[model samples]
Target: MKISAVRGVKDILPEEVWKWQFIESASRRIMENFGFSEIRIPVFEYTELFARSIGQGTDIVEKEMYTFQDSKGESLSLRPEGTAGVVRACIDHHRLQPDSVSKLYYTGPMFRHERPQKGRYRQFYQIGAEVFGTDNPWVDAEILSMLHLLFEQLGISGTVLQINSLGCTECRPVYRKALQKFLRNEQASLCTDCRRRTAGNPLRVLDCKRPDCKEATQSAPSVLASLCRDCMAHFEMVKGTLDLMGVPYEVNERLVRGLDYYTRTTFEILTDQLGSQNAVAAGGRYDGLVEQLGGRPTPAIGFALGMERLAALLPEETNHSRAKPLYLAPLGDAAMERMPLLLHQLRARGIPVDTDYLGKSLKSQMRQADRIGAAYVGILGEDELNDGVILLRNMETKAQTKVPLEGFVDQIAETLAGEGA
Candidate 1:
């Protein structure tokens, strides 16, 4: 019986992994440059954690989550997103003290049981960043600027940044009520999901992708129009700061993100290259989530980008070229005995080196080296060993240099360093 991978999951083969690594490393570099440290949260958490943080009415909590019960009769679930688990960790560790700020980023796989399509997978990876303990709109703009810098550095073009305000606790209800009332009148035109959301989470109905729902809600009450004095001013400052930082964005009044925890400002980076799944990255302020999850009242905002989607958009030229490893080929048993020590000595000096232990012929070994993209091949045959020398061949230029065995390790290191320089 041929056992295959389960459906909805994908194996990222070696050929495709460079794209993923390039995106991840670029994200890490941009994040660290902005003073954000990396945090690794668990892949699964107590079911109630997600239920409490992400509202029970949200699609993730209601349908997409992968939930199961343990032997102890406790329900746990694989995380569908990173924010809830990150917030849980911060509160659990008492990292969110009054007047303290923490900037954290996480990258890992999130599990959901939805039907996978072009960039969506059951086990998908995300690179996300979060900032806590600051309500200042400057932080919002700074993070957006950081994202702009990341995409610019990654050479990913054709992305549009859309921003919106979801209003705070004090003013959201007013908008929600008005939007709900408008949706109730157009209930016949909405999809089944939008119809159910109309009463419980009416704001979500406006975000529905159904053509009918979009057309029906074309005149729906805008959340931006309903923002209170404070929320409006905060949003204004966010936009002003973004302008001052030279980050281009459009104010999208209907851009309420999928998560229920989101409060004031919301934003998404959209690319038309991906069909219906246009949002490559999305996030917003979730100021109330900390308190909602048993922590002191805190203000925070963050965003996450889908790894698969971003990888797909990356061009071939975006991958940073890497120095190839040096391949070691030994011709005879006597030469093989000396090669291991030489390899160990060379590696201790920080050279990327590899060898084939199967004792293949010189021609076969050279082919293997070429197949692995080796830049240089060090041949230690019995003749060279007898002469106290090793024949080093530059695979790219086909240049051969005879390195003396007495101080061959240092000589090879110097040679590589010179070439690199």
Candidate 2:
């Protein structure tokens, strides 16, 4: 009987793992360059944490979260997103004190119980970053600028940057009331889930993707039109800063994120290549979440990029070609026995090298070397051994040379360096 992986889960084989590595390395480098320290959070947390933070009516909380009871009957859930866990960590660690700012980044898997599609998965990875302790619109601008730099470094262009203001508590209730009225009137046109959400979280109805829902909400009251003076000013400054920094963006009047905590600035980087679920990255400001989760009042903002989508969008040439490795073909048992030390010496010096340990034929080993993309092949047989030398062949040029085996490790190392291997 054969056992297979669970449905909706995937194994990232070595050939495809390089793309993930490239994305992670590039993300880490860019985040560090912007002074964001890395932070790791637990894969699962108390279910209440998400319910309290992501809004109980949201799809992520109501339908997508993988919730279960622990041995003690306490509820626990695999995280559906990164920001809530990050905020919980900050609060638990007392890192959200007055006048102190915390900038952090994380990369890992998140779980959801939903139909798996091209880019959306029940278990998927995300690269996210968060900034806490300030509501300055300049920070929002800086965050967007950092994201812009990341996409540019990844060589991904033609992505549209859409921005919107979700207003603030002071004035959002008015917009919420107006939006609820509008949605209630269009109930026949809304989806079942959206109809249930109309009274509790009307803003999310505007973010719906269904044709009927989108059409019904197209003329829905604009949250931007109802922004309080302070919220309007903050949104303006964010745009002004972006203009000063040359970050192009579009103002979407109905671009509310699918989270309850978002307020003021919300944005997403979209590309048409990924179908309807086209957002590669999205986030916004959540100035009230820190306090809502039991911490003293604090301001925070962050964004998460879908790892699967980002890897899919990565250019074909980026990180696709690796430095060719050195292949050691030891033809006899005696030659095989001597390879470990030589292999270690070369590898320890940062040279990529490998050798056959299966005691295969010279021709078979050479074929293996070619299959593995080796740039140079070192062949040692009876003739070469008796001559006290090793035959080194440049796989690319088919050039062969004999080198004394007495100090072969150092000699081969020098020759490889000289040949720019």
Candidate 3:
């Protein structure tokens, strides 16, 4: 029996991976320019790490996480999101002790067991940035601005920023009670999942997508309306900073992100290009996550964008642009025997070069080179070997030139550099 890939997992084949590389590279460049350093954490961690940091009441901890016990009886789970792990790393490594602000960016796969759709996958890749050690709304605005600049650099169109404040610790309790009371009056109209959330995390019920549940919660009290004085001030400052940065955004009062840890300053970058799964990136402030993860009381904010969704936004041709290869086609058995040395020489010079090892005919090798989109083909035949020279052919214009063997590498390097290859 032929085995197929498990459902909801995707294979990003070589033909399509350039898009992912482009997105990742662009994201990293942008983050670096914004003074964010890269941080890498393990794919799996103690299950309770997420349970505590993400809050047990949320769907990620309660339902979607890929949790299991190892043979040693230690319960572990593949991270379902990036923020919890980043926060865990920050606290564990004492990244906040000396600095007033710590900025970090990470890219990796996160696992979940949800029913996958257009942009959602069981094992998906995310590129995220987080800022710890400060609660200033200016930091929040910077995060948003960074996100905007990244998408703009990627040439993604039709993105809209949806912003909201979930209220801080001071006023969320008041909103929670009011939200619960409002949910109770329309209990019958809510979906089963939303009804369950009403008891555990009532704010999450507002984020439910079920049609009946959405309509039922339309009249539910907004957290924005109940923000305490401090939260109100912070929200205004975030807005003012965003305006100063010229970042356009819309106030989405009901945009309580699905995560339970989020408190205040929730935002999502939405695009209609991807059907029902339109949110390309989303995150918010989590003032209590560090404490929950066994650290001192700390405040943090960040955002995570799925690589798959971002790749979908990329143009097909841009994603398919082949990497330039220097094809080394040696004609005759003697030339083939010396091929390895030639390849090594090119590689030592930091050239991306490739050659067929299957002993194909020169014509077949050239055809293969064209198929792989090699930028230049090096022809080393018996005649060229006797003359201590190599024929370098420009694949684009079919132009050929003979260079002495000793100067061949330098000539190739000069041509590629001049062409911006």
lDDT of 1 by residue, 5-73 (tens): 998999999888898888888899999999999999999999999998888877889999999999998
> Could you give candidate 2's per-residue lDDT for residues 191-231 as a string of tens digits?
99899878777777887879989988888878888999999
Q: List the residue pairs that clash in candidate 1.
A: none
How much is the lDDT of residue 55 in candidate 2?
A: 91
**Highest lDDT: which candidate?**
1
Worst 10 contiguous positions by lDDT, candidate 1: 315-324
Regions of model 1 farther than 4 Å from truth: none
Give me the displacement of residue 396 in model 1, in angstroms.
Answer: 3.6
Query: What's the candidate order when arranged by decreasing TM-score?
Result: 2, 1, 3
**Can you give the TM-score per candidate against the true fold?**
0.95, 0.95, 0.92
Report lDDT (CA) for all predictions: 0.92, 0.91, 0.89
CA shift of 134, model 3, Å:
1.0
